[model samples]
Target: MEWLLTPGPVQLHPKALEALSRPQLHHRTEPARALFLEARSLLKRAFGTEGEVLVLTGSGTLAMEALAQNLFAPGERVLVPVYGKFSERFYEIALAAGLRAERLDLPYGRVPRPEDVAQRGFQGLLLVHSETSTGALVDLPALARAFKEANPEGLVGADMVTSLLVREVALEAYGVDAAVSGSQKGLMCPPGLGFVALSPRALERLKPRGYYLDLARELKAQREGESAWTPAINLVGAVKAVLEAVMPHLEAHLALKAWQNALLYQVGEALGLRPVPEVKSPAVAAFYLPEGVPYGAVKEAFARRNAVIAGGQGPLKGRIFRLSLMGAYDRYEALGVAALFREALADILPAS
Candidate 1:
């Protein structure tokens, strides 16, 4: 059995794998449309939104591009809160799409305060609900209130790629205008399928259809119970199966995550390992290496024992290591991984 601890492309449930192996269906066929509609309905329930859900055959980045390309006109200004690698990408995509983008940079492992964004005037606001790279969780409700108060015209958007099914986002209740996620993260399916939900007010900001990334066309096709282009039949089928299986047990899934994180923290404390922050994510836990111990040595030592742990991204590389507790992980698995990590660290850096 391969143990995966990385963020995206997380460990898949056996049922989801079985769903992917089912007989292929044509995208234009009646069965395909029914499946598409079923998936869309389930997605709404998953996102806890009454707004429209758009299914795309690309990654989560495609959903982001679609929103940027269709929602705003040229020269529109957007404010992106940059805390990790994925959050920073939102700014890059908006700029590349020809929109005026400004960034509010926050150090990794710390959430941005609402007052910080309230000072900046912008038409659109972007957030990464869970920054997997840094294991930082933003306060969605506070951020939404601050953005709306800062600029009434601002449409709030979030990248829920890492937090979706694992945590409670409640986009409608939280005042989020638009949000996006991929199938692989919390949805417990494979990559290649992107999910997007937009508020009616946010949808009203769209310009005329100019490209395939147009949300208008996607929405129109979705209204007819289909996708604009041929859909990813296998992946959509997997998503439908996964959602059906997990919907009733979502709370249990999140509880398992909590249990795993707590177990990891217990083991880390016993082993004298330092957590990166006082507030840790239930989705993932990032730890700082003991002083005088290099991250590379610890990573290789873990790899030798057939366990995979993630290293930090961008500037934090070589300074920290991340272990994902999302998906179907259990307390035993968490304990095993924690033992392996502690053993690895002990081998690399002895007590002094």
Candidate 2:
């Protein structure tokens, strides 16, 4: 079987795939409303919050832009901690939204300390819980607490696109004002649905931004089990299936993390590859290629073996490679990936 090891748009879970192929339902019907509402509840559990979770018909970036639009007015100063590509995207989005985005730039592999962020006197904070590009996981709870302590009246928004179902996040406990995520990464669904989970405080702070992304209007419509516009009906069904059929297995989550750590250490050591991040992520792993090993050759070799891997992006181009463990891979499938990875590597390395 072919392996999809890229960071996003992961191989869909079987249940989600099946659900996606099911007959579509009209968005205004009672059955459709129930499905949407149930999915929203499951999303709340996934985010570990009691607040409202609004579903939108776009990718994760849509939710990011929506947060920037609704949470802060134009010219409001917002602190963005940029460590990798995805975090930097938030910084750009803030600037594009007309916010005075102040970036606390750090190296690719290192994250900003919570104590350090508290000193940045911005009216709002934008966070990336897991940087998929560098495979670095941030201490989100600590950062959220620090931000709240420093700016009691300020808002804290998180882009949890890669971390939502892959890692544990307590939005309310950590005082995160809002968190945005997508269906493709941790949720093991297609790329159509974007979710925003907001605290009561954040909900109260929401205002009209634009027609499609206005969170206030979306919130009101979603509360009554409806959408303000036509929704991604099939994708919503797929998400509902994933949340109901796949998400309740707590043991599977624990097992996946343990498996991922073991696999990364074992495979990385065997290949003489060093991890790129100071704090690695369970969802994505980035490693520096061994000396003289061409990134293109290695990636092409994997592709020839029907194993899809990803190269670095932006400034990281050709410097590192990333492997993702975002889908619902069982023990045998995980072992298959490890074996295929070794075989693919052997195809490129010099003969012993």
Candidate 3:
């Protein structure tokens, strides 16, 4: 109802909404199997990979957890490049999954060059291709190459949830071992499906781990057109509808990114709210507030104007607010949000 702006729950298409209302099919039904298989096939194009695409019913983070569980065993050393909050997650997931994670820390606004991975020789690497918190997009391909050079036999997992379709990433071409993404963002679907794709090398590297989040078992079941368990039938249908109808226009998506970010940059310049210089992402814009204005005031200003946006996360909380343009954001809609942003920012700036 309100001008939908935050990243995850984007404006759903009427068709997708209708798909949710379709009769729930048994997970093993012939029709469900057909749609399920179709969605998996579509994901390969979505991720630019010919490898198996695993569609599991969970949040995007679950895809990361699945990789952590199956790919690395306890005490195996992994490298995590931490610059933003989401990147820090790799370290946490690694620790939780029993892998010993070493980190290459960079300043909040800075990005590590892709070749930086070649300098480290950890057994595996958990890389956040897109730093959601800081709106910094990392160089995934370079990192992938460097990882191979440094640890040819080790694994490399990418969290592509925010960057998957916003830009061009060839998962299979880049030789990345595994990657995770979600139904939300570029896919423009509801938030119930977590998608993963793995290279043959990644599968070979996977060791025995947890059961439910197991990618191997899920892949086998998915290939047969059924989930290993009761799936999110309606949500999967939504994914099918959106991917079939919306996600193919890569050029349009790139233009959408450009349009939204151009407006954001204009508004930011007017208000003197600047994104961190070096590594801004196409998916979202992260900007610091005007001097002396609290984070709550900016949020309140948008609320009063019939709009809402995202706040900062972790240590960056209270310092930056994120405007996500990942899903279903149109030029006109973004312009309207920019208008509201200008007014809100004007009110928050110091009376000089």
lDDT of each: 0.81, 0.86, 0.79
- Which is better, 2 or 3, measured by lDDT? 2
Q: What is the lDDT of residue 172 in candidate 1?
A: 75
Residues 114-150 of candidate 1 have per-residue lDDT tens digits of 8877855688888888888887788888988988997
Pick by TM-score: 2 or 3, better one: 2
TM-score of 1: 0.94
Q: In lDDT terms, how accurate is model 2?
A: 0.86
lDDT of 2 at 239: 89
TM-scores of all predicted structures: 0.94, 0.96, 0.95
lDDT of 3: 0.79
Backbone clash pairs for candidate 2 read none
lDDT string for model 2 (213-234, tens) is 9988998899988988899978
**Model 3 clash pairs?**
none
Q: Rank the candidate models, highest TM-score first.
A: 2, 3, 1
lDDT of 1 at 83: 82
Clashes per prediction? 0, 0, 0
User: Against the hidden true structure, what lDDT does model 1 obtain?
Assistant: 0.81
RMSD, each candidate, Å?
A: 1.9, 1.4, 1.7
